[model samples]
Structures are given as C-alpha cells and as structure tokens.
Target: MSDPVRCMTVCRVCGKEDWLDVLSFGPMPLANNYLAPAPSYDDEPRFPMDVIVCRSCWLMAIRQVVSPDVLYRHYVYISSDSRQILNHMRDVANLAVTRFHLPAGSLVIEVGSNIGTQLEVFRSMGMRTLGVDPARNLADLANARGVETLAEYFGEGLAGTILEQYGHPRLILGRHVFAHIDDLTDVINAATRLLDPAGIFAVEVPYLLNLIEGNQFDTIYHEHLSYFSVGTLRRLFERHGLRVVDVARFAVHGGSIVVFVGQAESQWPTGKAVFELEELEVRSGLTNEVAYQRFAERSGRTMRELGALVRGLVSQGKRVAGYGAPAKGNTLLNACGITARELQYASDTTEFKQGKVLPGTHVPVVSPAYAHDHPPDYFLLLPWNYAKEIIGREKSLLEQGIRFIVPIPEPLVVSNESLKDAAFSLSHG
Candidate 1:
C-alpha cells in the first residue's frame, strides 16, 4: 500500500502556513497505479486529493503529499510514446543548442529523462548527454538505447556525484519533471552547483495560467506537487540564487513554459519574455485568489458536464470508450465516478499499460490494435493535450462517422460536422 497522505501545514514555496482551499476530489487512488486483472478493489489504497494555494507566494499546490517512491519508482509513462512529444523534444533540443550556443562535445544532462528520448536529440546534435531518473526500468531502457542514464533520484547529493564524475554540464534540462519534485530548493541548489559558469539550466512545466483558463483539473495529480506561473517560478528560482534569464511558451502538454535560469551574478540579462509573461500572469489575475476560485467552480461544472455527456451518449445506445489511459485521464475518471460501465475500455499504445485497469475506475486498458478491431461508436479523448494529433491520426474513424468527446475547457463532441463548423468559424471570423 502507498503511504498515507500528509497534509502540509506550511507552504512548500514560501514557508507560509496560510493556504486557501481551491479544489478537492475527496479520496482518490494514485493516478498511475494500474492494477492487475481481477484485483481486489477493497485492498486498494486511496488518499485525499485536495488542492490549495499559498496565500503568500500565490503558488498553487496539492495539499496532500505522497511519497516519491510510490509515484515514480516503476513508472509506466514513456516520453517517446507520443509522436507529438517526440517532435516537441526535437524542437527543444534544436532551440537549446542554437540559442544557448552549445558547442560540439558540450555535456547536456537531463533530469526525469524517461527512456532518454529528449536526451537522444541532444546527442544527435553532437553534444554529450547524461540522464538522471528514478524509474529503474526507464533508466535501463535509456541505457539500452545508448543514452547514459543513472537510476537514482536527483537532488543535491546526486547532483554533486554527477558533477564530480562528468564535470559541469553546459545545459541541465528538466522537461516536465520539475513540477513533480517536492523539494524545489534542493533541486535548484543542485542545478546551480552542476551548471558551468556560462551554462544554462532550462526547466519546462505546465503553465498554471493555462491550467486555470483551460479548466484542466485533470492535470492535478499527486505526482505534480506544484503548479507554477511565471511570477511564482521567478520567486522560487530567485530564492535559490538563480535568475530567470529567458522564458518560452509552447502549446505542447496543453500549455508549458520553458524557463531558462542562470546564476544570479551572471552577466546574462533577463529577457523581455520573462517580464512579459510575468505581466500576463498579473493581468490574468493569477496573483490573486479570485481566479483560482473561479477555476474550482468551473472544474466542478466540467466534471458534471463530462459525466452527463458520457451518460447521455450511452443512453442513446452509442458505444463509448476512452482513447488514451494517461495519468490525468485516471484523475478525470475517478473524480467523475466513471467506471467500466461507462467507458468499456481505454485504448493506449503503451505496452506497459495494456491488460492493466485504471485505478479506482476499473476501466480495462487494451492495445490500440485490439480497440481498432472492436471500435466504439464514440471515443472519449483522454489525452486532450494531444487532441489534434490523435484526432488527425484517427481520421479514418471520423470518416467512418465515429465521434470523439473532448472533456476540457468544456465537454464537446468532435465530429466531421464540428470540424467543418470550427473551420468555417475561424475562416469567417
């Protein structure tokens, strides 16, 4: 069983004890804990899944803390699984190499480098690469693919060891991994130590503003301890003697921000992008509590709407199944009380997830090939972050009159008619 949920009395970002309740999903099983077939539900573990914001720092975070061991030791998600992610990682590597002026033979290290997909890009760019991740299986996969990876959690200790063994890295990249860390200080301190004098530390995380504005509550899982806006990220990095020199936004993963940091005393000047994003955050009311409250209200409404949509479709005798079994999808399913009764099964390309059942929901997971053989009338697109890619790839199904239900921002059905309407609206407007 996983460890009991530990409520935080003090905010991890600002050391303040004042917190404002934002959203709660009551008790929920770990999002990635896919169960064996015919497993006992009574023996499963659940923890409080509550979200709160630090009144002082304006940082959004989950109040309940789960052990990292339970979250990532044998992780199932692979970075290379998604074609969109692979393309995005290649773009990131190219940008980093060109923008940072990383010369050939410069060392690039990545934290949470699942299966070394991103690191492979850096290597292809003529840069030496290393990866640090806690998932032993993923680390082994990385090694097998010729990407040197360490099967250990990254922290000050591991950072020192890496520095001693490989010397200072020209670039330290953490893509979609920094938000999972509970100790921001330790990680930043380690990055500071492992960075060369002229090196850059680039970290990418899902943008808090996008999460709120897009009503992406499904992204709130135990693994993601903190949600960050540019303002909060600036403060966090500043506290560790690092300066945010540059910021870049990407539409991948719903929305993400890549913040490039350097030593506080470095000659690097803070780019206008950082100031612009910080200003945008203020304009979006991310510095206040009202935005979060509205987000919570909208989240509840989304849950109800998605449930209603799925049930309504089922009532019409239309078969519905989930398109992907992402961790975020589990949160959405469990929170909405959706079960195998609603979604017959979830189809995924990941072999690790095949034959397993979604936590709490008990929705069986099947291979994409199997799902195609027994296609449902409608597919609930679980990985809405990759909506365009998935929908485009499944064009044949849409042509065959199959529809997809996108449950984010608002629950809507995507069909040929909807596509034409959207295109017409955009072209006319």
Candidate 2:
C-alpha cells in the first residue's frame, strides 16, 4: 500500500503558517522498512521526504505525513542491543538518581521506551520503573525482562490512565522519540499532567547544529517530524507552563541534547546551558534558510563522492560490505543511488535484521560474522557516528587489512594503523 503525503500548513512550534522548503531527499522508502526475501523490488513503496523550516520559529521538519501505526507497529530496533546506547542509558539513569536525589522507591517512567533500556537501569537501582511503548514485541520483551510496560501510544488520555493506576512519577523521560511525534502539544500536556509538581521531565533530541555541521542530511525521514533547537524547545515548553531547567549535551546519535523540564512554579532555576545553546544556535544561523541551503549543497556533494568511491571500488572487482543497517543508512543508500551491485551486502548485529533486505536498494542483510568468513576488501561504516565503537569491535578486520570507509562528516578511508591510532586517541583523549 502507498503512504499519503500531506503538507504541514502550520508550524508545530509557534502555530505559524509560513514554512520555507529547505531540502528534498526525493521519494525514499520508510527508513525501518526491511523487506522479506520473497518481496519483489517493484513491491517496495517510497514516499517523498521534503524537509522544510518554519520562517517564524526556525524549526526544521519533514512536512510529508505517514501514519505512526504504519512505521512503528512492528519496529525492529532494540536499544539494549547497541553497547554504546546501553552505556549511555546507564550513565543517564545514574545521573537522574544522583542529580535529582530520587528516593529508593521513586517512580521513573519512559515514554516510547524501546526494550526498557533506561528503565532497566533504574530498576537495578531499586527504583520502581514503568515503560510506555507502542511496539508489541518490545513491550513484551521488556515485560519478560521485569520492566513493566504498557503497549499503547501515549497522549493526554493515556496519561490519565497512568495517573489513575500509578501515582505521579518523580521522573518522566523520552529519548530520541519527541521528534518522531507529530502532535507535540498533546504529548507535552500528557507529560505535564503525569509529572509531580516538583518532578523532572527529560527528553533527548538529536541536535540540529550537529546535523547541519556534520552533513547528516540522511537523518531526515518520515518518522522524524521536527528538527529542534534549544530556542524552539524552550518556547514550546514555556507555552505549556513547563520550564526547561537544565540542558546537557552528549555525543550520542551523532550529537544530542538532554533537556530537563519542570513545572513553571518549580523552584529549580534555569541553567546557563540552555541560554548558551540558544545563543549558539542564533550565531550559527541554525534558524536561517541559507544554512539549510548550504546543507543541501553539501549533501549533494557527499552523494557524488560516496557513489564514485563505492562504484569505483566495485568496478575494480573489489568487495564492499556495509556495517550497521540503520534507518539513516537506508536514507543514504537510496539518496546516493547505491545498490546491491555496488555493495554486496550490509551486516548488522541484531538477529532480527539478519537475512532480511534493506528497503529500495535490495542490499541483503547479514550477520557481522560474514566479515570473517567472507571478508570484503573494504567495509563501509554505515552508522558513521559510532565509528570509534565499530572500529574497536571490528579491530580484527582492521588487522586483516580491511580498510574502513567512513562517508559522513567527510569521506575518508581508514587504514589499519590509522584505525588503531584513532581508537587510542578516542579512548585516551
């Protein structure tokens, strides 16, 4: 079935009607849509991915609409599977406990929680944890692992049910989930209602500055409705009588900001980080159309360079297999016109993705063990943001003269010695 593309006539942040077209990735497949082996190439569906920025608020968003039910009903990603993500969650859980001084039985709730990665950390610390998620598989898995989860979409109505069942929570959180939602007002209202008067509500969003500076245009997809800046985020919360009390930046998912929100009447003072980041966004022209225009130009250049490198290698009879079959990878592959002929297959760590095929390009998905049995001459790091962890995990391949090709930020080849040196620098420095 084909998905519908609807134009967003109003700015989600400020309720303004003016929006400027920024970059168009053309028609692309749903980033997480992995195909069965029997499905023919013609059966695959592709939707338009036109990114636009609000002239009033400077928020970047994909106006093309696709139903969340079609995108996340049977999601494949499990946060605990990624080592880096698990570590980050642990760090966050610990900080929440210490910084907020959460009691032993304090309630912690995470909306859109995937496999209870963060909740599990809190549960281990003797805190009562609950996960609210829509993916049935993930919800069931989390329940089996002792993290009680509700398998339903979250909103104002659902928040009432939670409030009636479980008392107001001390902490409410979401990671990389807010941007995926279309109705921000409902979600924020729900969180505000369920939070204790003095409780903290935190969310992690991929930073817009990092996306533009790193040339990560492939991150745009139907699922992510908004590209937020601190200024826009602050405005959104202030409109709902919620105050952003703290802002912490981290290098996860390329780069992200963890924003802590509380009621407007709460005594917690707003931190300097929020204002500092807002100033940075203004100075960097993050809210301007010209910045996005430059980003589009860089994206085109990256597509040309990546295509030439991979196709040139294949033309010389060299084998190239991709590592990490992420949603962003599919965007890059389709936008760059890369096909199975150019790169033999993509390898992923998740067992569910093994044997499936990436959407659009028909690149077969296999296990990382393939690198040992049928090692490619050059391995393409699809999830280039985790280059350090990936290089360290596959150091054996590096030792075997398997040079890695990182395409984002800049296209470059990493030799064995260079990979070792880079890993050492990352670990030591």
Candidate 3:
C-alpha cells in the first residue's frame, strides 16, 4: 500500500544519509489509536510506520507524521507509578536546585509534562512550576490537581508565550520527550528563549547504546521520531547554542542517559563523562553502519526462532493470548509477522487502550479479567519491563500451568512457581 501522511524525516542532529529502510509495520494505524469500536469497515487511510536509519550518524527513526496534535493531545502517561521514576524526578529536581542553584520562586518548566507528577514535587519546593503539554485532557487534570499547565504544543512560539505570561524558567526539563520528534529545532529555540541565562536544560532519553546493545527496537515506534545518543544529542543541542555539560547512565527505560545542558554562553566544568561517553559512542560503533547491520542481522535470527515457537503452539491448538499491549509489541508483531490468527486477544491494564487493537497486527486488546474467566493455554507477556508485574498479577491464571513467554532480550518462558513469587505486579506496560 502507498503511504498517506507526507513527512520530511532528515536526521535532525546531522545531515546524514537521507534514508535507511529499518522495518515496516505494514499499514498500521496510530500506535495510540485506542478506540472502542474497531476501525470502521470504511477504508481508513494508512500512513507509513516504516522505520529508517541514518547510516552516517547511526540514528534509527520512524517516518510518519501523526501530528503531535493527534498523538499527544490527550496524554495518558502518569509519572508517579514507577517508584524508580518518581525517585528519579525528585533526585533530578534536587540536582537542579543545588547544581544550577535554582533559587526558590524561580520557575521550573517541563515540556510534555504528563499528569504533572514531576512538577508537583517541584511546586512543593517553592519553585514556580509550569507544565506545557498538548494533551488537553491531561492539562485540565493537572490544573484540577493544582499543577498549573498550559494546554498547547511546545515550541519556540510557545516559549515566547510563556516568557510573556510567566518569567523565564530557571530549570527546563524534558525527559523521554526529547526523542519523541522529527522536528527538534523549534524545541531547541524554545529552550533558548524560555531559559534564564544560567538555567540548565536537562533531558533524560534512552541511550542509543542501550538501544543497540539491549536490542531495544520496541522503543522504535511512530511516536519516537529519532533514537538519540550522547554523540547525536550533543551535536544537536550544541548546534542550537546549548552545550552538553554532564551525562549519567541510568538503569531506567532499559538503559538511559540523563543529560545536563546549559547555555553555550555559561561556564561549567564540562565534566569528564562528557568526552568519555562521546569517545565510547564512537568506539561502541554508534556512528558507523556496522552496528546497525549487526543488530538487523541478529534480529532476523531471533525473530525466526520465536515466530516458529509461537506458530507451533498455535498449530497444536493450544489457545494462546498475550498480556500488556506494549509499544515494543508493535515491532515484534511486524518483525515476526505475527498476525491476529496466532493470538486470540491481548490484554492491558490501561483503560484508555482497553478496547483497541494492536496497531499493525490488528490483535484485539481485552481487559485483565479475561485471564480469570477464559484463560488461554499460553500467555505472552509483551512488555518485558513489567513482566514480573504481569506474572504476579496473573498468578492465579498461571497456576493453571499456562506457559508464559517473554519475547525479546532472548525469549524465555516463565515457570509457574517463579511467576507466582514475583507478585509485585507493578508493570509500566
């Protein structure tokens, strides 16, 4: 099928190779298109969800334009759910306070602030806090929850609006939001205008090293316009008059880099980790085509084996279903070509997506109750991050000796006993 939406997807950080065909989730609808009714029989337009790579910069990206208006207009993510994430936000806030010397009453603004879970902590510390998010529903929710928010897309234009309404923020934070884009210049300009002279702009994104070494292709979706690394990110930020001062590798989001940047005009230590990571990125082969070639080759082998396993179970008439309709599940379905015939339905705890189908595979999403009443002979846990959580939550279902498979990072099965013991069930799927 021909692609619909027209989007120019040049590498934002560097003028690398114009294109590299990464993967194609054929004719997929929006990843977050969680509608109750099945997409009507009426023909619906399909935009290209095909992914690409920048051979020169070693950047992997998606080619699509669902427009932030349609994608992030009703943000559903909440930050406080994961204890690790909650603590990370508070720790970063403290770091900004001490390191940047963000004075009390000075502003701290977060672009793409979903649910204001992070900003609430900043507000408690006497910092004037503002949240910019396109999600209208979440903006109203944040306002009701006492975290003042502006319901609009953030860019240089929005930055001007903020400067006119509220004083420039002393600390600007964009977490995973940094990589969710095809156009980043507007955001860089926005940061320049909205930040005070010495203010720091901190971004936490999944390290490209993690994406490569960990085989995190599921992190590849339409929403994530470009996957970033210290090398690409530093180049992108510095080109916009911002400097990457320090970076810390954290265990969040598979593996991540928490980057600290300040005005190119400001004087900071330019920590050793800065150059070390850049060198490591080069040595790690992030900028070379070889790394991507290797990832794609290994992925081919991985998918064939797992696909055979699932197909075997299905052919045996063993009823199979899945848990956690995850983002990565999109890639898995496309790569392995697991269509709706293999699994009956997939279940997720998020109400916003309860009745929707997986974007590319058209796999129906059911509520968790399906596990208790009509459990499938086998259960597949799609979100490996919350595998333990799913195992714990559905221990009773697993007690029936239903085999649970964990796809990716090398597929493995969950033993019934181990699944029961891990009752935390705190899945971020």
Candidate 4:
C-alpha cells in the first residue's frame, strides 16, 4: 500500500521548527482527482487540509504533503484551455524576450510546462525552448507539437542530465509551478545549477497577500504545498545563493507575483518593484499572525454564507449547476459541504472531466453543449476568478433570464442588469 501522507515538521524555506496553525478544512479529497461514476465515496481517499505558517520566515504552507506522483503524473489541467491564459502567456513571452534581449537560438527552459503552450510561444520567437513536465500525456502532446518536452520530474539529478544534453539555459521559467513543489531548496538548487551565470530564473506563484485580501480560501489544496509572498520568496531564493532582481504583479490566477531571480554574484539590477512589494507585504500584515487568524475566520464565514445561499436557492426549486470544474472549485464545494443535492452537475469544456464526478461532492461533470441543451436556473460560477469573461461568454443565456451565483469573498447573484452595468463601467472607466 502507498504510504500515508506526511505532515511537515519544519519550514521548507528556513528549515525552522516554528509553526502557526492558520486554517483547517478538515479532510478533503484531492481537488483535481475527478473520479469515474462508479467509484464509491467509501473507497475514495481524503486527507487533512491543515494550513500553517512558519513563524521564522512567514511562509504559509499546508501541513500535509501529498506525493507528487499521485498529484501530477496524469494531470488534466491544460494551459491552452483558457483564452485569457493564452493571451497572458503571449504577453509573458514577448516581455521576456524583449525585456531580457534574448538573442535567437538562446536556450530557454520551462519547468512544469503544461502542453508546452508558453514554450511554443518562445520557440516561435526564434529562441530554443525545452519543456520539463511530469505529465506524460502533456509531454507527448508537446513533443508532437514540435516543442521538445521531457516527461520527468525536475530536480538536481534531472538538472544534470539537461545540462549535459541541452547545455545551460539562458532563462528558466516556472509559472504557477513553484508552489506545488515540496522541496523548495532542491528545486532552487537545481535551477541554479541549470542556469547560465548571467541567466535569470523567473517564477510566478499565487501571491499570499492576494489570497488574504481577496479571501481566496478555495485556492488552498493539497497539490499546492506553499503560498508565496515577495518577502518569503526573497528569503527562499537568497538561501540558495540567488537574489530577487525584479518583481511584477498580474491579475491572473486570482492574483500572482512573478519574481525574477539571478545568482547573488551576478550584476542584475534589483528593480524597485521588489523592495516596494516587500514593504507592502509587511504593511498588509503578511509578516504577522493576526492576519492569518482573520483570514481563517473570514474563510469560515464565506463557507457558511455560500452554503446558505445555495441551499436557499434549492429550497425555491431552482436548478443550480456549477460552471467550470476547476480544481479550486472542488475545494470550495467540499469545504462548504455542497453536493449533488445542491448542484445537479458541473459543466466544463475540458473533455477529461466531463464524465467524471467531482472529487468529494459526487457532482457529475457535463459538457457545455449538454448544459446549454438542459439549462439550469442558475450557474454557480465555480471558477469565479474569471467571472467577467465567463459571464460575457454566456450573454445569450443571461439575456434569457438565467442568473449566475458567484461564490467567493461573498455570495452574489449576477443578472442581466448587473452585467450590463459592469460592462459599461469597464468600457467607460
């Protein structure tokens, strides 16, 4: 049998034993582990989702660490699925090439490059690109698309192999992947070894400040081992002989911060963005325990509010189905104890999730075409981060008097009138 999931004893960044309990969602199923219709809940796996913070480095992370093999080997999240993400990646690629002045044929490597979408952008820009991802299916697709990808977990050993075969990379970028890593130091060391002396390592992770401020408790799951802030990232990179040279914030993935790191001895200029964000982190109470306590309380309130809202709608004989079956959606559903009784089914575009039921709630996932054929009274916006884009996409349904329930930060129902006003504000503002 597989070993039980283990609790973290020391901080991954500072190796300190000091820890502060932040929040607990009791036991939750693996957020991305969509099950077949046949699997019984009695046999389904669940683990503790206790979030904690390191008092020494102020790094927030989950106490239990699930094995990466079970979490990522057969992943279903496709980066190319979202149009907004594609545009964001295009922007990221263009900025990296132009801002860094990456000449043609410069080797660029991406860790956890899902389906090689972003790396393909780099390849199109005349740069040599390599992608390292653990998902064999995605790696195969990436290779078929001409973006040479390796289906291997990256660490010190694989870093040596890549260095020998592909030479040192001019840029090593990981988008939303660093937070999933359990061994931050090992990954940082591997990155440091695989990079050229003058190269830069850019990592984009969900900003901790954004999580607390936006009350994005749904983003917490077992796969995401760590939550980062500019301050914690600075400490993490510095311990591995790398320095944060630059930082930028983006609204994608709720909110994320891309930190640019370089070898400490390198002459890369530290941008004002780094210092400015670090100060902001301190002023926002990210470096203290009180903020976490408040966040925990707020998360509980959100769960209760969302539960009451959905239950109320069900009592009125309203048919509510979830829109978008993202991993975070599973966390929210399980945490709030919402099941198939509340949400009939979750509609998604991803074929991999269409026939499978949600991790714990047993809410069957359906295709968007099927959902449209059998429309519900309200669509519980599961991926609330893209509320505007999703609401705009279903304009016809909105015009037909179908409302949407957005459950995050608070539970709010969106109607045609509200959407029009929002669109007008966006256009005029």
Clashes of 4: 0
For model 2, give the 10-residue run with minimal summed lDDT: 420-429
On residues 1-429, what C-alpha lDDT tens digit does candidate 2 reach at each position? 654556688888999988888888888899989988874678677888898888898889998878888888999978845778878888788877787788999999999998887887888899898899999999999899888999998899999899899999999989899999888999999999998877999989999998998898878888898988899899989988899998888888888998999999997788899899999998998877889899988999999999989999999999998887988899888888898888889998888889999988889999978756888999888888888787777777878899888888767888788855763343210
* lDDT agreement with native, every candidate: 0.88, 0.86, 0.75, 0.89
Q: What's the distance in Å from true for residue 147, model 1?
A: 0.6
Ranking by TM-score: 4, 1, 2, 3
In candidate 3, clashing pairs total: 2
Better of 2 and 3 by TM-score: 2
User: Cα deviation of 295 in candidate 3 (Å)?
Assistant: 1.1
Task: Report the alpha-carbon TM-score of model 1 versus the true structure.
Answer: 0.96
- lDDT by residue (tens digit), candidate 1, 265-326: 87778889999999999999998999999999999999998998898888999899999999
What does candidate 4's lDDT look like per residue over 1-429, in tens digits? 587688899899999999999899998999999999984679899998999999999999999999888888899888845788888888888777776677999999999998898998888889999999999998998899888999998889899899889998989999999999998877888999988778989899999999999899999999999999999999988888899998888888888888889999887889999999999999999988999999999999999999988999899999999998999999999999899999989999999999999999999999999998999999999898888688777889989999988887777888888877873221110
Tens digits of per-residue lDDT for model 3, 144-221? 999999998888878777888898888889888888865788888888887777888889887889788777666676
Residue 145 local lDDT, model 3: 91
Decide which is better by TM-score, 3 or 4: 4
How does candidate 4 fare on TM-score?
0.97
How do all models score by TM-score?
0.96, 0.96, 0.88, 0.97
Weakest 10 consecutive residues of candidate 1 by summed lDDT: 420-429
Alpha-carbon runs more than 4 Å astray in model 3: 1-4, 7-9, 16-21, 24-26, 39-44, 74-80, 388-400, 417-429
Whichever of 2 and 3 has more lDDT, that candidate is 2
The per-prediction CA RMSD against the true structure, in angstroms, equals 2.1, 2.1, 3.6, 1.8
